[model samples]
Target: MPIRTTETTVTLDHPFALTSFDSVLPAGVYRLEIDEEEISGLSFSAYRRISARLHTPAIGVLSSIREALPIDTRELEEVLKADRTPIILPAGE
Candidate 1:
């Protein structure tokens, strides 16, 4: 089976907690890794998510070690939607 791994980062402005973590995480940039497997028997190529992992302690932190935690992608998306900073555009045409 062919599996594809995707890596990305998420940023939160305020402290947030995740079900997979024991404590609240500080606001900063966090790395998210997702794995998806290609599905067969289809006319078009498609992939389904297999798993998602979040890197602990945020990026650029002075931690000796980092832990990859298994997380629910939907939950993470909700958290991000609630925690994301809104961008304001200048008044101009």
Candidate 2:
């Protein structure tokens, strides 16, 4: 999910460049258009914050480790096959 506030029609050939300020968009359904034609629809959600720190002494070590990791295609397939359920987070919990 992404955060989008305003809905503006842009040409598909030249999509509007996104900026940090555009990141302030609220969560909602969005319709993407190109030359007055509806191209796609997207739902944007609030940004999720993450806080983590990794301490390593070797330079470029983390890069190598990340590259060595294997991508599980089955996980992606399962996500795509799963039913579409609205993700609801507890408010101020």
**Using TM-score as the measure, which candidate wins?**
1
Quote the positional error of residue 43 for candidate 2 in Å: 42
Clashes of each: 0, 2
How far residue 50's Cα lies from its native spot in candidate 2, in Å, is: 34
Model 2 stretches with alpha carbons more than 4 Å out: 1-64, 80-85, 89-93
In model 1, the Cα lDDT at residue 8 comes to: 96
lDDT (Cα) of model 1: 0.93
Residue 20 lDDT in candidate 1: 96
Pairs with steric clashes in candidate 2: 4-25, 5-25
Q: Which candidate leads the pack in lDDT?
A: 1
C-alpha lDDT of all candidate models, in order? 0.93, 0.27
The residue-by-residue lDDT of candidate 1 on 1-93, one tens digit each, is 699999999998998998999999999999999999999889999999999999988999999879999999999999999887576788892
